[model samples]
Target: MILDILMTFGSARKNEDDCQFNGYLEDYLQLLDNREEHLQVLFQKVVEKYPNARICVGLRFAINKEVVSNQIIGYKDAFKLEGKALIRSL
Candidate 1:
């Protein structure tokens, strides 16, 4: 959905003169930040069920509380994840 929205704007005739679309993208990112707490809770639950499984969380570091690093699968920089609520075996 987001990619479609972005792509549509990129192809617009006045795309080079547009800033509204960029603002929309920032709003979308802000909404993601608002859900960070809820996502962190879900992440904890999954870690509990699979203690031995490798997991990685994603974040923008400087953008504190902006979003949970919820990309546990198919993520490359797993070690760069700095914060953790828990990592011990169950």
Candidate 2:
């Protein structure tokens, strides 16, 4: 079974956009903090459940640890970012 955790990242993006639209910079940053924590925990859970699970970093975020470089999944066609443009936009 293939598990797509990208949806979780998508939701966080949406939330950040909404917070920014409402002129809530603090709220957006706080949302990012929560998301970072969640992603860290989620990654741990995934690794525990699927010892050999493959993770695709479709979106970039900090998870406080190094992910196995060899397990990188490519999404060049789906996501194209120049430098830190995506993060700067947020």
- For each candidate, give its TM-score against the true structure: 0.22, 0.27
Model 2 lowest lDDT segment of ten: 17-26
Error of 1 at 1 (Å): 31
Candidate with best lDDT: 2
Model 1 agreement with the true structure over 1-90: per-residue lDDT tens digits = 654453433211244422222333223333345548675566456556755333211211222343546564434354456644222232
Question: Candidate 1: where are CA atoms >4 Å away?
Answer: 1-35, 56-90
What lDDT would each prediction earn against the true structure?
0.38, 0.40
Best candidate, TM-score-wise? 2
Q: Give per-residue CA lDDT, model 2, range 1-90, as digits (tens).
A: 234443333333455421122222333333345548865566566656765654333344432224534445553322354432333232
Q: What is the Cα-based lDDT of residue 35 in candidate 2?
A: 42
